[model samples]
Target: MKPPDGPDFSARWAALRNIPPFLRMVWQASPALTLAMIALRLARAMVPVAMLWLAKLIIDEVVVLSQSGGPATLAGWWDSGLADTLLVLVALELALAVAQDLLGRAVSYTDALLQEKLVIDISIRLMDHAAGLDLASFEDASFQDRLDRARRQTMGRIPLLGQVMQQMQDVLTVASFAVGLILYNPWLVALLALALIPSLMGEMHFNARTYALNHARAADRRERDYLRMIAATAETAKEVKIFGLSPWLRDRYLTLARRFYEENRAIQRRQLTVMAALTALGTLAYYAAFLWIIARTLTGTLTIGDLTFLSGSFLRLRGLMEGLLSGFSRMAGEAMYLDDLFDFFTARPRIASPERPLPVPQPIRQGFRFEGVGFRYPGREAWAIRGMDLELGAGETVALVGENGAGKTTIVKLLARLYDPDEGRITLDGRDLRDYDLDQLRATVGVIFQDFVRYAVTAAENIAIGRIEERDDRPRIVTAAERALADQVIAKLPQGYDQMVGKRFARGLDLSGGEWQKLAIARAYMRDAQLLVLDEPTAALDARAEYEIFQRFRDLTQGRTALLISHRFSSVRMADRIIVLENGRVQDQGSHAELLSRPGRYRELFELQAQGYR
Candidate 1:
């Protein structure tokens, strides 16, 4: 069935229907706090009715005392004993006032705690879900839009949870007032309800329009966020300053923000006009009711206390009804926004493991074989790799040499199963790659891309991230660092392995590009996987350092399979065999001497680089 195209009342109602699940999530965050908040709200809800009634009693007592010739002076009034009833009523009011204040404080405190807990819970869930999605999903612009919206809702709509509780308390308070009015005259209840509907409808309509506008502008909002970050962040500061882009970026932000402001301003103006008209109608109704009550009081049918109580009740009822209706509309809008969060949560990962996954082969004896394999990234026309045929034997080292954009990294990704081939198949030990468990397959191959993350954490923690379970294993960390030739570099720091590595944090000591590469290479060593793919691991290292690292690489990877991608023919020649790639196809494959003996692309490219040095 086709989904609905635009915002509708039904979708808004459905958003309201998500309240139970949201509450359930809040409850799951902290049942004790949730219960405390509810209890406090309930207790606070009745205080208004009690306080109003007590005021009526005190007023009636004052009227009686005055008619019976009360004392003139303050001291006389205190001693006359005619004021005793009033004093007792005043005492009860003071006590109720204190209790109400305390309950309100308690309710707010509980909500604040619940809000933090809910934010943390929702944030964790978002991270976990994003981690499970396929690489393609992250690359798609539409999927990014959905993710951005959901992320904003996670932090932005936290107030919705507390608003729901407030609304509930308001409902109970309104009910108490409604019952009092109904006792005096049932028609008064109907009059108040009639007055509220028009404004309520207006609020609900504007809310839907607001959500629709925000929904359509999600991508623009993302762009605004990106531009803001780029204009002000440490990572982009150098480039932004060099290019003198501050004014341009600022203007761009203003343009987008102004468009949003204009659209929102239009809605707000319409909403205000409708609200004013409806509020005027409501005022007329209230005055008409007020005049009717006055006539009854003048006719000797109702006492002064009754007059005060009914008037107060009617006024309170009007405000409470207005709040309840408008709160409901605002909440519907909030819940509609929650559709983004729920929609993201509901999205199932296409790359999830099968229910009954085949076990990963032990030792991977036959190695990996790709036959007629092809894959194109999402939303791209050309294939990244096509009609590919390759084989990596167990314990053999292979080098993939190619110019930029020749599908070098794409092959590594395919081999690591970051993406499944769109055409043909990849098999490990004669079993299709998808047949094995997803996690196990990833665990079996360790890949370090050219652009690796430089984490702003302790040196030990940085390496530990490669195999997080071994974070506490100091010996394993040391061994991996030693293998990556990072131990001596780390030893030079004041805190050694405990030293923070990135410049982003306080007291952090930044490393040179070569040092950071060495640290990243340590992560692969930490993985200790059977199949290792290194994409230009020595790009930042000096020539001597590069040759030394490759020497260590050959020595360290004696019994394991490895694939090295580089433009440097010096490193490529060290491989047991070389495969030259061009335009997503393997143009040639052989040892360095055999390729050099032939008049082919590999020989021409090799000589081109060699001549540059002379």
Candidate 2:
């Protein structure tokens, strides 16, 4: 199906009115700075009004001086006073210009302070929520997109709010100009306001399109950005060079960036042309009024000074109106992006703490049972796993063997409670797994997948990441590394456990494939959990290393229930029980001796692998 059209601008504007008691919150947070900012803005505005009035006086007085017939004329009487008035006006203008500059500095510093506070507040709040979300939700793309955007862009809202503060000064400046022009023609003020209507409309139209573009391209933009990172980042550089794929990847990156730039620039060009045409029309009308006032003064319908004031104030009045109109639209557009950020900030987690959670009842002693379990992903035609039945007794190490698409990972995912079963009950001991606190349940299980991460940090940090809270426990970290046979790696390093493990940063060393697998095993061993899963965990290890590691793995999982997957039949032969699966259904399950003797699918698959190894 086609995706929905992009953002709704009208909806976002309404959100500002709903900003949770706006001024009160801002006032309570920084009242003194807020008031000081307003006062400076008001004082800056007065300088322009006083300048226009002085211009009108000088124009009329100079014209009269030019027309003087007698030696004692109005100009002669006021010659010395004119110099004083001009000096005072010049001084006022300079002082106001200086004050505005000071205010510009103050606003920048104030914005910096506000932005820092916002980032801190939001990061803290989001991190707190992140710890509460289910590990399964992290896999959901929609959830990830929200979390990513909020974390990256939410801090920009503060500067937008500061822009709104500046707009307040612009609005007041416009009002003062209108009041000063009243003596010439009251209707001229109304005309000036009317002329701004087209420009305001044009601005709103452009903002709508811009916001819509942002909303629509968020996913693609994220992809392009991530690809650029992969292309340029130090960690990916070695693999890219060794594989001789840098040229191909660079071309692909340029393709995506060009697409984004071309589309946005097209829209910008169209919008800019429309706004420019409207601005030219407004300029024409403003000058037409200036000429009309001059003609009226020439015909003796108005005083010369009145005409001068009317013309000077008219030009300032037009600028002030345009600034006000554009400022409002700018503020609204900025707020919409903030709303996108806010949406992520306030998202409802797929799994959250119960209103009144019962403490975790003891560790599983009986076993886990899946009765008529089923699950289908969003926008899928069929269930990934459906109506499956399985039982794993406590302390039993079972090996699940299957072909490529046989749903082995799906079952393991369910066992981890990353996604709830659609049509089944999953119970631990005798109670449902969902009834226990999510954190408690997850804390009891540990997993190492074929695609484990290689953290570009210290050797100790890489291992201790399995239990982040226990990272500072040096004894525990060392023990876990020793169990995974990674102590030899530490011994080879210049600084042992303190040595950096990846070359992304300074003073770091890269690892071989087999070595990285050992590090992953060390990470898994650090979890100290009852249920452990190793999915093709030794796929990268050499034959001898793989075999020896299995011997050590037996020691690491001595007291825990474990699940191991391997294409190598040697590992499967050692499991207490073997479950052969074919296309999402269990074909047979029994001890190695029993399954080998039975001449079933397990025996056939075992012989095929055994033939290859020979």
Using TM-score as the measure, which candidate wins?
A: 1
lDDT of each: 0.88, 0.75
Each prediction's Cα RMSD?
2.9, 4.7
* Position 610, candidate 1: lDDT: 85
lDDT of 1 at 75: 92
Model 2 residue 453 CA deviation (Å) reads 2.0
lDDT of 1 by residue, 331-390 (tens): 999999888999999877677567888987778798889899998998899998899998
Query: Count of backbone clashes for each model?
Result: 0, 0
The parts of candidate 2 lying over 4 Å away from their true place are 1-95, 119-152, 155-159, 226-262, 292-312, 345-347
Deviating ranges (above 4 Å) for candidate 1: 1-6, 69-85
Model 2 worst lDDT window (10 residues)? 1-10
lDDT of 2 by residue, 1-614 (tens): 12223346566467566344434444555666657666766766666777677666766666665575434656665664544554565566567677768767776676566546555656676688776676656776777777766666546555665666667777777778888776557878877888888998777767766766766667776777788888878768778888987787788888878877777787778778999999987898798788789889899997777877787788878887888788777767766666666676566556544666555545668777888887776556677767778887888788888787677787777777777788888888877777767778777878888889989999999999999999999999999989989888788889989999887778889888888888898887899888888888788887678778776776668767888777676677678887777766778988889988987888888899878877
Candidate 2 lands at a TM-score of 0.83
Q: How many angstroms is residue 53 displaced in model 2 relative to the true structure, after the best TM-score fit? A: 6.0
TM per candidate comes to 0.95, 0.83
